[model samples]
Target: MIFKAIFSGFGGQGVLMMGTSLAHGAMSNGYHVTFLPSYGAEIRGGTANCTVAIADEEIASPVASEPDYLVVMNAPSLFSFQNKVAAKGVIFLNSSIISERSSRSDVQAYAVPCGDIAQDLGNTRVANIIMMGAFIKKSGIVTPDIYLKSLESIMGGRKKGVAEINRKAFAAGFDYVKD
Candidate 1:
């Protein structure tokens, strides 16, 4: 199966991080993976998006004009790429920023307040991991453990006390669906 996903939001929202972690997880699973990131000149305060595709066979294009899954972290992220999803695709929104709900009827949309969830867990910055946890369960691209490993690699050891909080945040988000 070819799985294409897009992560979009303001730069600090960790959209690109989600794509990178997902790509690494898929690569660890021995699947062909491609990660493409798009950013504007404004950077951190500007728009950013990344496309991650995992396939059993050699992947085709890295550009995902129509993605199977979308992880949006902000209102602009939703408005910018909501129409880019495929007919049967799913859009996962960070409900903390988007409350009105998407009106697209052709695709399945889910609103997860990952930022709020992370804050409730005592770390507002681990929102990305929270979103990833929810995404893995919803998309089935990789297990939460693999995703956590990928996240560990991405966070590395230099980013202060991030890894532990991120792990906790991911666990919280993962458990949210079950509880």
Candidate 2:
């Protein structure tokens, strides 16, 4: 199976991290993966995005012209990437921050309140992880257990207590989608 996904948001919103985490998870599970990140000049609030390709076979390229899945954390990202989603694709949006809806009817939409969910979990920075959880649940790209372990491995020595906080954030997102 092959899956192409794009995660887009502001610079500080962990958009790249989300894609990186997915790539790591896919790689750990014996999938071929590629991660490519793009960002604007400003560090915190400027546009940032990444494309990740996961497949059982070799990846031909890192660029994703039309992705099967999209995780957009803001209205701008939705506007920018919505049209590029493949037919029958799935789009997950941070509805708490973005009031706009997708115009395409062919793609499935999951309007999870990622920002609010992260805030409720006492950390707004983890909104991306919340989205990640929802994506994991809906798409079945990677199992939660595998993703959690990959997350922990990726967070090694990043900061104190960050792994646990992110773990809780991911669980919150996963539960939100299941319900």
Candidate 3:
């Protein structure tokens, strides 16, 4: 199967990290994948986004002109990428930081309180991880177990307890939608 997704948010929100994790997971599953990242100059609060394409066969391109899925971490992201999604595509919004709603009816939209969930998990930085959890749960591009393993692998040689909190954040996001 071919799955094209776009993750967008402000800088320092881990938008690129989430896309990279998905790309890594797809690679681990023996799928061909491509990731393209775009961002502004600022380290934080500037626009940042990434496009990831995963498929069973050779990928023709890395640009996601019309992605099958959209992960919006803020209202601006939702507004910017809402019209770019293909019909019947899925959109995941971080409702905790964004109070607005999408105007599209042709696509499936899920509002996830990623920021609040991360705060509840004791670290607001993992809000993107929470979003990743929700994305994995909703998109099914990769299994949650595999994604978590990928996350741990990426965090290799990091500070102690980072994996535990990230795991909990991922689980929180995963269970948030599952329940």
Candidate 4:
């Protein structure tokens, strides 16, 4: 079974990092994965998005015309990609910034206050990581341990305390969605 997901938001929101982390986690879990990123001309404020495909078998393409999961960190991303989600797909929206909900009834939508959670954590930069934690918990595509390990690998070179704060942020997001 192939699972495709699209993560979108403003460039500074770490959209590509979210997709890349998921892809890395999936790959580390012995799944075949692909990561494709797109961005506008502007470096920080422009639109940025990425598609990640994970499967037991090799993937044929990196593109996801109709993704199984859509994660939107901003309002514009929700409007731009909501219709592209396949029927019965899942959508995770950052309700902290986007007040509007998905109009589609066929899909399951989750509202996570990622920005607010990160702000409460004293680092708004980890908003993407918070969203990622929620997505992983809900989707069960990859274990949180593996995802954190992948995240640590990706951010290992960063300054001290970054990983700890990200872990806390992930835990908060994961806890926000009850099973």
RMSD of each: 1.7, 1.4, 1.4, 1.1
> Which stretches in model 1 have alpha-carbon errors above 4 Å?
159-161
TM-scores for all candidates: the values are: 0.93, 0.95, 0.95, 0.97
Q: Which stretches of candidate 4 lie over 4 Å from their true place?
A: 40-44
- Global lDDT scores for all candidate models: 0.85, 0.91, 0.90, 0.94
Give the CA lDDT, 0 to 100, for residue 86 in model 3. 96
Model 3 scores a C-alpha lDDT of 0.90
Tens digit per residue, CA lDDT, model 4, 1-179: 99999999987899999999999999999999999998446665767899999999989999999999999999999999999999999999999999999999999999999999999999999999999989999999999999999999998799879889989999999999888
Query: Could you tell which candidate, 1 or 3, scores higher by TM-score?
Result: 3
Q: Candidate 1 on 36-104: residue-level lDDT in tens?
A: 999546745888889999999999899898899998898888888888899989998889878766778
Candidate 4 lands at a TM-score of 0.97
Which window of ten consecutive residues has the lowest lDDT sum in model 3? 38-47
Number of the top-ranking candidate, with TM-score as the measure? 4
Q: Residue by residue across 1-179, what tens digits does model 2's lDDT show? A: 78999999887888888999999999999999999988446666778999999999999998989899999998999999999999999999999989999999999999999899888888888998988989999989889999989988988878868988888988888988864
Write one digit per residue (lDDT tens) for candidate 3, span 1-179.
78899999988889999999999999998899999998446565678999999999999999988999999998889999999999999999999989998899999998999999888887999999988888898888889888888888988899979999998998888888863
lDDT of 3 at 97: 84
Overlapping backbone residue pairs in candidate 3 total: 0
